[model samples]
Target: MSRHIQDRIGRRLSTVFPCPDAVEDTSRLGQVLLRLAQALAPAPAGNPVPDSFRTDLLAAVPQLRRYALAQCRNAAEADDLVQTTLMRAWENRSRFEPGTRLIAWLFTILRNAFLNQRKRLRREVEDVDGAFAATLSLEPEQERRVELIQLQAALNTLTAEHRETLLLVMVDGLLYEEAARVLGCRTGTVKSRVSRARERLALALGTD
Candidate 1:
């Protein structure tokens, strides 16, 4: 990567992984970083995936993982979703417009893959009883852990539209116009959904 492109990727990564306690944070951001390093390992010779594509994908990983985790609420499954998204993006990379927001395009792909997966598994029973949560080892900071749990639970209560909109606009830092493009809606609609999602989240967290 050129120095300018490297700097740009660094900027995006900082935005996505801004937490000083990211390694110790209970939100699984650390896992995303680890997987990112693994994911960017050099593609084998004869592999058609372009280097620029790989660079852009690397920059998008943090946002993609964060969005996936919010959608699925399972770290492992969310990682799988991101992997699937990357594969699809690589396969169809020729269709992507140059100079556009690559993260937004990847988000659209990830969201579609997740929705398809949900449809396929609609009849199956998920971990509805917090079994996975029970297995996670919490840190020594009880208050912060409890707060994160509370926030995650609040996020879970949001409708799918609200949650998707909130994460795309609020968490992922997409412009309303870009978010609307990802969500297949008008800009005004994106703004409305984000407003309602914020209201709902605040109400759920008792911050309103």
Candidate 2:
């Protein structure tokens, strides 16, 4: 190894990669370090379907729905997209890089499926003057439903990129790096989109 490379490593100044299953602190700096390590590590080759794959996938359904609704704005269409994504992910299990984050993988599949279907079907639904809010629900069932309507409308006004970014980072709690992976974009792009989305939503809802 060159002395320059060794010096970089000794100082921990080299770039770090991200890995799916590496659990670390929630802080942004911590995530950055973890991702750096992940990036340096070789990808797990082949598909050794983990025992939790099915269960984990099932668990991710609600998140998938939230993302889908934000993307397509219709409840039924969101459900269909989730279904299609799950089906495709399952069918392509062998292609999945092992030891990676399942949700990110599934999300990538869902996103691609959504984009492809949008191209073919171009199906549009009435957003009820409000797109569904991923975070809606406060009081009584009926009242919550009403609030959700308004939230949905506000959500619909956002650009698709903003909506998807908010859903991934805010709703799903994915780190920016993880979100970038799922969205097939850079971490900087994910961060920017989330910032813009939050500002727009705050303006729309008049929240602090």
Candidate 3:
């Protein structure tokens, strides 16, 4: 195995199987280590989570909460959604594909969780799409600034599906494929939504 693979396996093993130092038998310790190494090894075709997975999760929570809050109406709901997302991600960590965009994956989880919660509680009163546009519709003294704000607000007026597609593509800088994965849609769908969203925003802001 390459050094990279070995390091990854070592990290996973440490997380899953902490060695016991109380055992004075050298042979037993060796056996335990061997068992752990075997268990931590990657499958034939699948990439296991890297050592940095936990570190990445820790680093991403703040940004993830911010994104969730932007999508949600209230701080309490956003915080709950973020907490649930993190718990779910940690629980299903093994299923996360390696070398993928972790932030996108987390965002997808948060979005799904939010939708599910809304369905359960029937509390979909505040429309983020409308709120997003309203926030951006401010008139500033600077002509250049006002125009930019208007454009941003126009983007917010798009449907949830469209706004998400555009933000994931334009603001989040995700490629079509990655955005599709995050949105749980096909690449073609993502492309169409992004195109339609841009056109609508342009029309809404009288830039068409």
lDDT by residue (tens digit), candidate 3, 64-101: 65566667765556666766777788778887888897
Report, for all candidates in order, the number of backbone clashes: 0, 13, 0
What TM-score does candidate 1 get on C-alpha atoms?
0.62
lDDT of each: 0.66, 0.60, 0.62
User: What lDDT does candidate 2 reach at residue 185?
Assistant: 89
Badly placed stretches (over 4 Å) of model 2 are 1-48, 122-128, 131-157, 203-208
Count of clashing pairs, candidate 1: 0
- Using lDDT as the measure, the top candidate is 1
lDDT of 2 by residue, 1-208 (tens): 3444323222211011011122235744235334433433434565344656655765676667666665676666766777677667766767878677888888888888887886797765344243223334334577544544544555667676776676677656678998999888899999998777666555443444
lDDT ranking, high to low: 1, 3, 2
Tell me the tens digit of each residue's lDDT in model 1 across 1-208.
Answer: 2445333333432332232222332445456546655655776776555666678886777678767765676777877787788778866888988778889899999988988898898843232234324534455688645644554565556566776776677667789999998888999999888777666545543453
Query: Whose TM-score is greatest here?
Result: 3
Q: CA shift at 118, candidate 2, in angstroms?
A: 1.2
RMSD of each: 9.3, 14.9, 15.5
Return whichever of 2 and 3 wins on TM-score.
3
